[model samples]
Target: MPASDDVVSHRAGLLRAPDGEALPQRVVASWQRSADYGVDLETVEPVFSGTPVTDSLFAECGQEVLSGLHRTLENEPISLMLTDADGLVLGRLSGDTSLLRALDAVHLAPGFAFSEREAGTNGLGLALADRVPSVVRAEEHYSLSLCTYTCAAVPVLDPVSGRLEGAVNITTWSRSNSDLLLALAQSAASNTSALMLARSQGRRPRPAPRGEVVRVESARLEPGSGTAHELGEAWSDAVGRAAHALAAGRVVAAVGEAGSGRATLLAQALRRARPHDRILSAAAPPPADVETWLALWAPEVGKPHTGVIVRDVDVLPAWSAPALRSLLVGRPSGAGPVGGAVVGLGGGRPGGTTAGDHPASGAGWAVTAESANALPAELAPLVDVVVEVAPLRDRVEDVMRLAEHVAHRARGRAIEFTPTARRALESCPWPGNVEQLVRAVRHAVSRTNVVDVAHLPAEVLSGSSRALTRIEAFERDEIVRCLTRPGATMKDAAAELGMSRATVYRKLGYYDLQVLRD
Candidate 1:
């Protein structure tokens, strides 16, 4: 044989050495003398506690260590394994199973001991015996079954005290480079140990809070009267404390009326706290036609008007039916109004009192006052006297028809616009009733070249469809054009105009147009 082939033969011979003469035996013998002092399987097994580690610990460790190992060995023909101190396999990232089984049959499996005196001489045994890192190639293991496997293992130590924490191992076929594998395993073990140590020492910072309160202003006064300055100061202090808490890693949610000065309070709190923290206020104005008393406290409060109808009270059925349909469609409708009834709209005493009877009547405020005697505290303030309207079932068919029409149009055009249109058509308060649908359709047709739900303007998307009637007029004009064309067979008219022949016939029938010449 040539010199290069001889060297390969010699290495193969070395790997195939008998169990007693294997290199793993020598390494394990030496390691057993040092770290194994007063420690044997009998004494160690009972002391090995199996406490479950926290998920956060695992997640952090995986992020810091496992991710790196995955990236480094992604294309390499190697299998990396990490085991806990008790020899329980924690995780494994492998290249191939045939190679893994070959490694395993040689006592190179994770969680299996290959100490010289025990199972006898393997990379794992030698590394444990030496209390360091070592590599064992084919014939390097004392066990006969492990002759075809090559493995490298390193003991990870706790960074603070240098105590053995766990072991990291890399296993490959005997053809692999043993020296390189051992080096990589040792490096990975070291890095993992450092990460664990840093985590134990609280080196990692906590996640930032979700939100903060910038400012809060409130005042204490009689139940029916205005708030005082002291209350505002107290509210501001509360907001500041909340913001501070958020900065210190706490989630915070705020709720109040439109004019409750909630935004100002949140803003002030943010100014005093960390700039990185976010502050949010949920104080949306009431829908039109509903007088909002809360808007009075808003920094930008405007005169309460009756022209604006608060859909919250007026469009109960419109909202409910779509929600019910959505639920039936397997999509979540979220939480609907409690007790499955519209909140009544009235103030002071509940019984049939007009707006003129209320104390805030001159203030032009509409308060959705809860019936304190009948409702839960959280829901009480939302209860205004019931606004009568048609039942949900009466209008649901129309909304559904419109939604279906828009969806069909979207699909035919191969446009991804159904969701927005569907949502608008389904959710909007159709105050002008069916007439509104006609105008909205026309507006959508004109404004959109390719109708997509997302392209619709926000207000129109969320508004009533009273404008769709304009679209109907356009449809009518197209129908007239199709019918007046020369040799306008119903089939030709339907095909050219994108309408059903039956629909064209029905239109002709309605207009008393004779199709067959007598």
Candidate 2:
């Protein structure tokens, strides 16, 4: 289908679309955003940004995935593309000379940025923008020049961390059959992400410490709204488990997503049982300084009133594992001085004594990581119990309570969220978990007396839910867009959604979209 008069008029800054002829809500939203960005409707001149990412892990893995896909579509006039998180085109592969030339004309070749901010609303841009798989068909593109092509793209995320790495885009002529384009793009993107994860797991990234020892502040321990009783059973249960394990002189590892309160859970547990214990925290240092970093802290770990929490033990070098093992498990008799001049953490004198010289049980030990499986092999055996901190999304009921708690802490009083803001918070996937919620609430409270939808971060408003599949996200967005439109009624929304009024009403409640109206 060619560009409709409605689309042409909408592109010219007229938001009106014929009631029955309205475009997909995602496309309409993108068009509005493009206008807001000052994108030219007549052309799409994507900015030439960074140099091509030819040597990086993402590019290497992406190239391999695209290469295999290219062979499958050998004679097809389609192009496969890879872009960085910023939507800078890193690589492109295609056998169709005509399509290649046309792509180059629109600055779709390597080293140009096709992000919505740079190029306008297109497949790769929308995927990167929303961090979801996207399909932009003819006339759906914000830029008129891009309307000649149909594009399917899927954002690639770090398999372990869930960070957006980039996107895989497949493009063909506007009239080409695109029934399988999105699935193909999704598969290639998933494979590229898997390969990246596999390569990274083979060799752990270098550990970079955030600095030195930090005394877990007593201020954080003071009663707040995010107290044990209020944070839900899941949270309280994890803290209880850690406290029990630590009180029994057992090494505990708090495992979960990076910011899901792994350290907070362990620290809260300690404050409850041993408030007088000096809880010191430090992150794993660089590979070269591992020995020195360990040596500096080894002396404190042997004391009766001291407790230690090492962050990101997953990144510790393989060679330094045994030294860390010695710290937690104690040094064997006749073994060389651990870390060379470091006193034995297993409760021994500086001169070098057996594991029995001093009971290593006096001080508490714990570490935090993404999971128990991520811990170093040498140190894994030393962890007596693993306390799993559930990600924020798992406990949606806790979001508002935690938000209230975080806001009070930020403002030194109280701040509240509007119904719309609360729904946005509750429905979000919260990839950064509790830590992110705290930061967002703090940020919002600092700017406003009452947190509203406008005060929240952009990611929170537009974030894709991890629990929702790509198709579900598309449907959810459609329902939300239709229901939330000004002057839209149930009959109109149901008609727009192609569902019965009853079905639309049921789905509206199911998606927690009532807040969209408030």
Candidate 3:
């Protein structure tokens, strides 16, 4: 159900994030995600900044673009930023010195990670996360600090890989006409992607020179899974297999513990397989129209380049399994499933032993597919290939790179991780995988500027005596343990803590411990 028009208008006038009932489901979902990331709606802190990148693959890809755009603006009060796929600032240009100072205060510089999780619902982050060009008007942003400005951003995709390589964002005071700004931002991003694709293909003719544009295309999607291995090996052999599966036009299943960055890898594959095609996304539990959505699958019947990517198919409902199978089953190559084009199944526990069975080589292969592993039995046979992503604990050396990645994302700027701090980070156990690491790093960045070992969360560095986190951890633990006791209640716990019930619940919500209570 939708909100009343009067209620919607009131919220819109106040520049508040509309209640879930008032906004589109996707928009509400994004807002919920923002809150979960701990973004403060009232006080927008510049704790999250972007990180700097060396002269590398993307460093030169979109060079001089900002300067040229600035020239065209001719001293207009605007700022332009080019960021890598992670929202890490790569290049930035500003026309007005005053506006420049204001943006700098918010860490909107080259090399900061402006990802949605870090910066709340802003242009660059939303564009990258949703993979669509967008405009964020004043107060539309989750953070109050960004309310005075309007921004438009578009994701820049790798021509060959179809991966989200970066994004281009144009920012101005909220009073400006954003419709024009959005078009300009999209044009800028398109031009940048074209430049990158030209280099990758070596055709160099410009003007969509390859005659095809690509995005989210990668078998080697993302920066492999970590940086501690060879090439600081970000990708494990499983990723290579996943890539192979996509290229082979096989039904690819990427299984791993949650937060292993499987989506990042598969999204790249989707791009490579489709190149010129648009992908319609459906989740497990199969949306009501999923069959209908999948039925119109033909790239030759005026739909020459569209595909279906049903996520988390491992848990695909039993009833819908046959429907999906019948829709895909086996339709010969180039019919609908080409370049691993038909569908991509993401997430589900791997089969067999807990990756303990396969024994990871330095490249970090998590598992080998067998007859009875973690994947659902019915869906397994339908899947043509499988790639496993190992947990962060298995790839211990990669923690620092992962931390830096998160820090750049949360802080929206660069913060060096000292060798000593790196060792401290690597020593901890990451039980929640990437999600745990991201939360810990975001907490640390919010608390300190340097990101030293001392800056990390107390939970991350267990058995270490840090007066503040130690006390907080001890108190929270005691509270949780007591609350979980048989017949325990919030009233009893609040009395024991010598605080009001409201304060107790506030702290519970703050620490995400509300679930511990009845």
Which candidate achieves the best TM-score against the true structure? 2
Estimate, for each residue in 325-356, the C-alpha lDDT of model 1 and write its tens digit. Answer: 22212233333222322232222332222222
Q: Which candidate has the highest lDDT of all? A: 2
For model 3, the run of ten residues with the poorest summed lDDT? 358-367
Q: Which residue runs does candidate 3 get wrong by more than 4 Å?
A: 1-25, 46-51, 203-252, 255-518
Q: What clash count goes with each model?
A: 50, 0, 40
Sorted by TM-score, highest first, which candidate order results? 2, 3, 1
| TM-score (all chains, Cα) for each model | 0.30, 0.50, 0.43
Please, what is the whole-model Cα lDDT of each candidate in the order they appear?
0.42, 0.72, 0.56
**Clashing residue pairs, backbone N/CA/C < 3 A, model 2:** none
Please give, for residues 1-518, the per-residue lDDT of candidate 3 as tens digits.
Answer: 22333433455455433343344333443454466566666544534443566465455656556567778895888888887777777777776888989888887776566776677778787776666677787767767788789989887766643434777888999989888999888778777766665544231121221211122133233223222233135454555656555555455666666556565456545454445444433433223343454444322122334334444544332224444443443332212212211133353432322211211111111112211253433345445556666777777766777787778767788877766567657766565567678777887789778766556554554422222233466666656555544576789888887888898877666544423422
Candidate 1 structure, TM-score to reference = 0.30
- Local lDDT at 345 for model 2: 20
* Cα lDDT over the full model 1: 0.42
